[model samples]
Target: MSAVRAIEPISRGEFSKMLRRARPPPGWGKSIAVANSGGPDSTCLLYLLHEYFSSDGTPPGNQRNDSTSNSHQKANPRIVSLTVDHGLQSSSADMAARTARFAESLGVEHSTTKIPWGEGVFPPLPAPGAPFEETARRARYRTLFDEMTRLQANALAAGHHLDDQVETGLMRLRLGSSMLGASGMRYCRRWGMGNVIGGLDWAGVEGMRRWIVRPFLGVSKDRILATCEANRLEYVVDKTNFQPEVTLRNAVRHVVKYGKESAQNFPPKLLQDIETIDTALENLPNFDGNLNSGPERLRAFVQEMGREVEAIEKEVDEITHKGRLPSPIGTFLISKEALEGIKDKPLVQRALVLRILRYVSPNPWGSLRAQAKRRSARLEELARCLTTPMSALSKPFSMSSQVLWKPVLKRPKIVKGKSKGKVPAGWIASRQPPDLQNAWGVADRDITEPLLQALEARESEGDGGALDILFDCRFRIRIHLDAIPQAVIDALAAGITNLSIRCDKELYYPSVVLRTPKNELVLNPADNPTPKFPEGIAFAKPVDWVSIEFIRTLGNI
Candidate 1:
């Protein structure tokens, strides 16, 4: 048996390197929030971030040779420590309080938000040792992002480390996930976008430009604990993690830490024995290159798969760029020629369909409606329909709360004075009319006030500022921040009620009405050709539209 390699405390330089590798967006570090749970991982991360960003006296032997080494020398980033209490246990609040004290000691502002676990708000609290990890996680992040909106942060930093990544990968593998899922967590991603766990209610945070970053994803758990000890940092331990039966992730973590064949039944006897002796042996430390050998291989595999997925995603982006165009009135124009060009590439077709469906869906990606649309067979069928001729798909199809109507054939319109006819516009994707029953009980969705409030916040800052918000997860509502019209303000201020009506089947949102305080009908932007400032608001450039409660509630009626 080989001797075990010593796990050394993570050096300051190493920490800085990990953060750089995360590739945070331009405005990320200026104002950041940390999702601290009072655990060792988060506690250590908080201390490291405070030290890394602060201009205080630098610890000896922490100098870096990189050009950006001097960047942190006198840096003072706004670091807010945020903690979410799931309220699953009685001590959850106390744990959050302790985290606040720790953050205060480091001179960092702290905020703790509690999740109200009850009927309609969240699923009923799980029974003892029952499967509630995913629910708790989703609700925790949901609350975190809500607080972030209130604080107006540019980024969120999490404490997910390499060990956590490995556990995630293993759990996904056990669940028979694809390479993309088994690749585990990303270092940085846009908040409330993609098929991420906490992407629920994305419209609320759309255009916020907020990112969730994991700087510790490359660091190991052993090294993290060592760093805490070296820095004399204190953190609480959650006993729930030790019970492998509670969750698949916890079970995988046990197998990774202690070999699966441990006398204590490390993975628990009742759980399926998914890990083989070969994989378990690889995790054991009694081998040459003990610390780096097996885990490094797994990390390399994940990284390689991540690179492949990134390339595929880039390709999808390129394909969509040529194929998809947003119409002036909230609908998307799909070029028939572009779809035919990629008809042979089934993978790209499915991906493209997924992207478009996600964009046009009235509900967020994490919602039940959106989840139902994620079926592989449905995507494949949609891809086929999209590539087929306009006459083939005569009937409109509905999925993900959006309707894909019959394609508009390319034809030359009446020309006058040497002017060219209307160009070849293909299929139109619009929001699905509300059923107001079954899963979705709410019929009317009015977000005029919240939308106005968001615009007002941006308007107060300065001129030359523009804000784009997603309305009903379907329409991209762009407003000139500097030129918020008084009429628009009056509409919201007077408690205006807005709703979309199917005035014309051929037109995208033919008529959208806004009722004023005196029950007056405001003109629909889609119907108006030469609208004034308030109605002219739709003329601005488009931006991302994903949201939470307010926008989630703003469904098509």
Candidate 2:
């Protein structure tokens, strides 16, 4: 290790220097887990933090008389340098070992977790390719998170940088991500990973004990590389990163860098423009109410975006049909349809889409172009060279064609809501008869429209999600349906006996299941589906609460 030097010096304003000075805010737990893969960014972080803390005892910024001439303020966490070995690489185990040694060299407490390492391993885990990358990343997190909890490490850290962020934003942009995806990574967020053992929600959740941290996001790739260079550190650059066909991040890592550099030319001006966009977003009065509406404005946005999303999907389908992967952006943008499909749970859906898209590589058959094409000609020549036997120990070679298998969506048209309707053509399960589909979105209008509108108004003000009540109708309303669970049927029938229908309108949508009086034995229509409980039964829909006297005969109890 040697003295540090800047790889790419920031022009002060271009970088978010505030992050350099920013400490974890109050209430955020403190012990840090730096995912020190021996990558330059992480190594830099380790070196800075180790030095930062060490120097603090001697003096503030000013050096004591015995301090070396060029020494800088050491920046360190109460650092635990952790490495995740996905074991997809032949050198992965060694990489972990080497990283551990390197972390020790930096005078930091280091640990390593070997993930997905087992017998029958080949060039990549599960015998190499795109699936291997996902296997590696997920395993890496699982191990890291597990370690975080086992060690009770309070904050989980990573070495993601500006270049990575820029690449991610570009990837999201290409994918036609909705507003949140376009928002880029937040500085911090609660980890979605949580656990409950035996249905008790306490400190028992596995990963919930540790908060994920990314201190380096506000920094640049150059700073990390500079730190690595200054420390004389060696990082193994996985050959797959340069292979475009393997991951969108690799492709955009190349493509997005240009934009980052171009922004450098007029850094101040571009930043000013970015700030202007922020100002506009900030000025918009209620985010969900105004711009993100259901009528003309939002409907138009959805309509226009609807075209783009459809076009992108068509492009992806055509490419796959032709036995190829779309460009990184193409794959990402095409995923918006999948995201839009789960509109109610937007964040969950976006995360799912992002996780799946990151595994695709642009190059389909990267290494074996000539061999697979000229197989007929090689047959005769190979007959003479039969003395040579092939071995799995063939110097870590991978043909990459194995990773090119296009993803097959076995179950399409995943309508997640209790029900949905008016979806785009080709979006839902086509097998579901069209007439049934037509009635899918048809709201039951007569259950009391004026009253329901009032309920909707109350909900608009952030009331509880829905209200359910069951009472007898004076108007002989013959509500017929069979999908309604027996318990609900009994409740509703009993309610009808002593009925006083006041707020009947609130019970019209998918949230309510009505049954005709004749089908009192069993009345459940297409409107609802309940989890099958072999014994105790379940609420297929809201529990119908009839007036007092009606309750006596509910469920014929």
Candidate 3:
């Protein structure tokens, strides 16, 4: 085969266009943060952002303060640089400090957060392997998110590029990932720690959300290096990246760019270990093809998969919009008509069911690849069951902590002796109620801490602030801080900690309640949905503070 041709370096105009297409949330215009590690990719991104913001008349961080400029005219968002120092290497601190200095030189705000690895926060790092890589990454992102929230930024940017996307797709393919899973990283997405709960208004939230934008996903790594070189910028190189034994990603990088002979560069014992891993992976049933084939072919394959994923997502949105019923307090409803429409196409049906299950699941679907596959198979079965006639419907079943009930059809009127055919409504699905005898199958989640955290964030943003909190991982409750009664605010501030949401046993819907440390009730919606309390603690007039909704699809929130 002929050698691959070298690509041209990215021009400044092209980089600008890519940034425009990155599509950071509109709220990010007020303040945005970047994850800068003092590497070539990040360093170039920092410089370009500074340049991009500066090119538009006024520089970033210079919000107009004169009387002539109104609040809306302060369009240049403040740029913040965040560095997570893992301290895995001796030079980690120094690298972070250098990055801070570089950012400050460009008038960008900077902060460094040190991960307390092995210090009770995160467990001691395991020996160099795939597990170590995953652990380290989790620690790094957790720190970054904490800092971003405290700083009140809107979004965090990462330096992931097209090469990283190709590597991720290849790795997923080797591990037997689903087609949608193998599409690799998204250009803009919610934080992975939180599962994909879609459909939230982007404007009203306080502080930085769990969003990470990747403008460079379509830009090649070589272009990043070229950008840094052409502008005469210096960056640090992490030497450990060259050592393949440290992580699977490093090993894959070697195999993709170099050949199998790259393993010979390691010591005799290490070389043997690399070959063993390669053999094991190749023996897997779903290992698609040889990674030794150049990166170009792998890049093309991921692009095609990405197109297919987009097409599937579009179909999902269409069916969901046309036939979805407005979700009640704790249940998800899909019209029987919708299911009947897609009855013959099992692929679309399976995709729709998987999305609904993920949205209503009480537990987050973290890196559980095997369990996800099993659940996918079960979801496919449920999808097929939707096509069964109402007369043949089976008993209610449970999956992912939610109960899929038999279809609820509108009954015929009894005015006439002869009955009319049944009216089609929809299938109702709900969370499994907690059962004392069946401890293993019980479903319960206490969202007190998350609620408290959100309230604190709202307090920091002052009055009239709005934010959405996920209750029991099922309901999206949008809280308007200004509309909350002063009594509830005082109760929270006075050290009452037990805030909870419970479903009515008979009605099977949700209600809000607050209690003291000993579980003594402070406030209960059941006492009166709108009651007057002592100290003139009446429910705010026309209370529109809290609005609840349910997710219908898998997209960015």
Leading candidate by TM-score = 3
Residue-by-residue lDDT tens digits, candidate 3, 1-557: 99987655666676666766665656465667899999988888888877776654343345545666454565666788999998777798999999999998998889988887676456775554335566677678767877777887767888888888877875665554556666788877655334323312111122224567888888778878878888888888898787786666787777768867776777565565456545544553444555565677656766777677778777888877787887654456888788888888765776677666554444443213212343546666777777665542345666543454556777668665876657657777766665532322223344556655766887787656665665545445565667767776677766665555544443234344456555433233332233222232223223456565543224422
Per-model lDDT? 0.62, 0.41, 0.64
Clash tally, candidates in order: 8, 20, 0
* Lowest summed lDDT window (length 10), candidate 1: 548-557
Pairwise TM-score winner, candidates 2 and 3: 3
Ranking by lDDT: 3, 1, 2
- Residue-level lDDT of model 1, residues 129-235, one tens digit each, is 67677778877877787787788777788999888887676666554444545567888866643342234434243533567889888778888999999989989
**Model 2, span 499-545: residue lDDT tens:** 12221121111223333444311122333332221233223323323
Error of 2 at 232 (Å): 3.0
Candidate 3 Cα outliers beyond 4 Å, as residue runs: 1-6, 25-27, 57-74, 118-120, 124-131, 192-208, 260-289, 340-347, 365-376, 387-392, 401-405, 411-426, 436-470, 475-501, 506-508, 514-557
Q: TM-scores across all candidates?
A: 0.68, 0.41, 0.74
Candidate 1 segments whose C-alpha is farther than 4 A from its true place: 1-26, 56-76, 90-94, 116-132, 173-176, 193-209, 257-296, 325-329, 334-347, 365-368, 371-373, 384-401, 405-408, 411-428, 432-470, 476-557
Better by lDDT, candidate 3 or 1: 3
